[model samples]
Target: MKVLTANRLSDGIAVWYADGGWAETVTRADIAHDKAAEDRLEAIGAAAAANNEVVDVN
Candidate 1:
């Protein structure tokens, strides 16, 4: 399993991808249970980074 995480570029606060956006905590983080889900998370992370919303996504 995997969960997408990153730091908000604006305030450098840790965040996790939940539902369709970033959340301050991990309790509701979106879980990737397979390769396809992982890929989706990666793409979302990349887009978030490209949009200057987050950094160090993993």
Candidate 2:
């Protein structure tokens, strides 16, 4: 399983990280900035922030 953390960029894009390494960078345009996607990411961020662990789902 791969753990990932997403950081929202100033340009409104999200950059993905895994184990403190860069995984990928996704823009809002890439996901169409949908509510579902935003909510999902927010949930992951919240979990990560609370536990100080990357969220992994595989």
Per-model TM against the reference: 0.98, 0.39
Best by the TM-score measure: 1
Note the Cα lDDT for every prediction shown. Answer: 0.98, 0.44
Alpha-carbon runs more than 4 Å astray in model 1: none
What digit string (tens of lDDT, one per residue) describes model 1 on residues 1-58?
9999999999999999999999999999999999999999999999999999999999
Q: How close is candidate 2 to the true structure, as a TM-score?
A: 0.39
Steric clash pairs (candidate 2): none
Candidate 1 lowest-lDDT run of ten: 19-28
User: Where's the lowest-lDDT run of ten residues in candidate 2?
Assistant: 23-32
Assess the local accuracy of residue 22 in candidate 1 as a C-alpha lDDT between 0 and 100: 96
TM-score of the candidate numbered 1? 0.98
